[model samples]
Target chain A: MAVRDWEAVIGLEVHAHLKTRTKMFCRCELEYGAPENTRTCPVCLAHPGALPVPNERAIEQTIKLGLALDCGIAARAIFARKNYFYPDLPKGYQISQYEAPLAGRGRFRLPRPDGDREIGIVRAHLEEDAAKTVHAGGATGRSVGADYSLVDFNRGGTPLVEIVTEPDLRSAEEAVWFLRLLRQTIVELGISDAEMEKGTLRADVNVSVRRRGEEGYRPRWEIKNMNSFTFVGRAIEAAIRQQVAAHEAGEPVEQSTYDYDADTDRLTVHRSKEEADDYRYFPEPDLVPVEPPAELVERLRAELPERPADRIRRIEPAVGFDAAVELVTTGRDRLYDRLVAAGAEARVAANAVMNEVAAAGIDPEAVDAGELAKVLGARERLPRDVYLEAVARSADPGFAAAPFLEQEAVSDASALEPVVEAVLAANPEQVQTYLGGKEGVLGYLVGQVMRETRGKADPRVVNRLLREKLRA
Target chain B: MAIDREQLLHVAHLARLELRDEEVERLGAQLNDILAAVSKVSELDLSEVPPTSHPLDVVNVFGADVPHESLPLEEALANAPEREGSAFRVPPAGS
Candidate 1:
């Protein structure tokens, strides 16, 4: 198949569990790894004569995320009942947003190597999560080939926000980068834990392929419930290949849902018999519409923190774009900024933080920026061993640089002349090789001088002395 | 605006109801009568009024983000038709 002739249009529907203490529309406490059915109440258990009440913190958090992404907060948000049937959904329906979502029509700037691309946000709505199902007596202990399943309602009714993106991504790599940036943004906003491993963050990837200049859309396939970024990328790639191959064979691409197996690297069509597309959505009468006060919207917008894209932009010129992206997303940019404010050079401080400080397993927050800045400033003057040890212990409460700073490398030329002469006499062959125009041998002579002084002698001075003596 | 036999059967199937052939015909007519009664509101030309989901004008009803005690495990599982340990047991998904 001529894959180059086709382009893949990809989108993502990301669902993140909110960090509220209670469930979305119930009073039961949100707890993970609790005993089965221990966290359920009458409201969440769908008992008769029970009324659902929305959690205020969940709504506020969702709005804060929307404001951070530059979305328009709806004057009135409506919750609608999405009708469905399954044991996991005890209410036989999920209360999700239909026509009026809490947030709408935002754009997220995704930083790419070529340039920054804008991914359109269709909407971000609030919903409740379903229970956890543990399939038993299955071949692989999964839902496939299972004899029976058990339901744990502890996670049921958890508040979730579904953020849908427009089909703006053209490649799987772009999709992954967008997710990474999105996760960072969510986490920095303090809305959710957003841990994909813990199942707090999940995604549904939609993909379709069209000719390079095609105007209309092709039938898209939805890969459901992906938890890993790597798997999302691979699944989209696989979908593109399958659709392109169908086009090459002059067959039409059918719209359907699929399940991707990361282990086997295969996509199997999920045969859903319940008319999965027919949700029959209608307004939920049990709950009232959510109208965020204008004052509240203004307050949240004003309190929004510096976004990841803006943070990357601020630090890009100093450390370049890639390093800026790395530092900001990993949450070490604040410490780097503080160090720079404490009079440490930007590039030196960044290198020490990313390389030495990270390698020593020091929490950047634990280290006092002033102390670390001093240590970084003294790096060239101190020996290699001393400098690394200072960085490792920089997080200690009683850390001081005066003791470590005293073991400065001997840079005096006369003091290192004898050591350089002894090294040159001992290694006559190397000295001859150096004089015979093999310039690389000068490094070996410098090493001998450094070892003689036990790493206290400055390598730069030793090199200058060795080169001068070798030439004579 | 009227319900037909095939549509009635489809709705019944979606709701997991077992309807005999005679019941389908009877329910079809009854559903059409109910629709005809409800469709009378569409005749009015009150385009200025907005649609509403609830009878009351209340909006933004919420509870504080606080934890409350959940029912005991045994009491929570009291009404389950089938049980396994502390969880509710059911047939395999999509069975």
Candidate 2:
């Protein structure tokens, strides 16, 4: 069968490190780029007799995220130990949620170009991140094929929220869209920095392909530890293509783990990863189960900012879905609303804010809406450069639009007639072409008149005067 | 049910332990006895009792989101068998 005839079932496990003041179980500061191992303590270092204590803020932040996703918070949640042996895991296991995660069974309304896609949230559980390991014996910084590694425990024990989605996404594009919305929500809730470049947000993608409308699921392959969304999308697409080929060849796509070489655009199976995932899990004896009080859960739910879908839907009618998404995601919708309240047209204000102000590097938070509205109101009558300059300067402290409004174009027809006449007299060939019924030449004549008036002459006035003289 | 030789060896491997033949025989019997003793509770009808993760009755024991003084770099690396600059050096971790 053709690749298009096969549908890809995709799910994502996103691990976002919470931007807490301290580690999840220790008092060490969660500072990025800190000196290696300096942030370690007895608990995080796994020294004997050291006990683990949960950070109250990290738990509250995770609950806040679960509420934002509209998930059912667990009445009782417990931490479990996932046993493994690695240099990075100081405790020889990872403390994670197993039997009862903090939240589950929520739905995220993923906005698509066609409409919204409701992706099911399987769970969003809290866990601690592993220490960072920098392998040696490769090229100076690369880790592949290294002889040994150096471990930095500074990142160990940091609070991480693992959000898992059901295999509800069909294509790589939908998965990317879903992640964008999720990241926006996280940022809006002020929980995590969620920056991919800094290794704060990571994703493990599961991909399987079955015949379209087929009843059960096929075995899936996982692409692990992808940090960039672009690479994630590409890796999933590549995996789907491979699986489709395998299916057509009558070969089983063995479930395994893969690493995507983004530069080469290839997926290679990890030979060392055994098929068996035997991380024997049991409840952590050191910590007790969490039962969030009814009052606190309600309070966090009430404190959530407007969901991204709601914001996009509310602004979609006036500006359009694309513009509305841009406005909402970049948080320029607040300025857009204020501009509308200040009497500027909705679409025009959106375009100006997304384009002109953004291109000028103006922070939307720093811009005064009323002053920008005045400049936008006079845009048609003002010279193009002056209007853009006014918008750029609107973010300045105590900015006023009156000075910029004084530079309105020379719009009087009589005042622009002499310049328009000279422009036509100077270019007889173009004028003859206009008389010969080439109407497009009219724009050239207006350009000449505007040039003569140093761009102060309104093109509309120049166009009218040029038409009258040409007819005469 | 008691764990056989293969199951005991599998558990040892999962814990990253390499067992000698004699130790395996010895530990297998010891493990079976331990499992038997623990499973004796299953004979009782305790379905009404809830499973407890910790012996303490407390829940929601949390520390504030505050930072304290971390160990000095020298002190942190003092117990390391191997060190590279300020980091703990170890063997290359395979996938």
Top lDDT hit = 2
Angstrom error of the Cα, residue B36, model 1: value is: 1.5
Candidate 2, which CAPRI tier?
Answer: medium
Positional deviation of A206 in candidate 1, in angstroms? 0.4
Interface root mean square deviation per prediction = 1.1, 1.4
Candidate 1 residue pairs that clash:
none
| Best-performing candidate as measured by DockQ | 1
Q: Model 2 residue A135 lDDT? A: 80
Give candidate 2 regions above 4 Å deviation: A138-145, A273-275, A410-472
For all the predictions, what are the DockQ values?
0.76, 0.74
- Residue-wise lDDT of candidate 1 within A1-472, one digit each (tens)? 8889999999999999999999999989998888789999998889987889999999999999899778899999999999888788998899999899999989899876567899999999999999999988878777767899899999999999999999999999999989999998999889999999999999999999999999878999999889999999999988988899999999977889998877877777876654746678999999999999999988988888899988888888899888898888778898899999999999998888888988999899998888889888888889898999999998999888777777779999999998888888899899788788999988888888888988889888888888788667
In candidate 1, position A18 carries an lDDT of 96
TM-score attained by model 1: 0.90
- Clash count of each predicted structure: 0, 0
Second chain TM-score, each model: 0.93, 0.94
| CA lDDT of each prediction against the hidden true structure | 0.89, 0.90
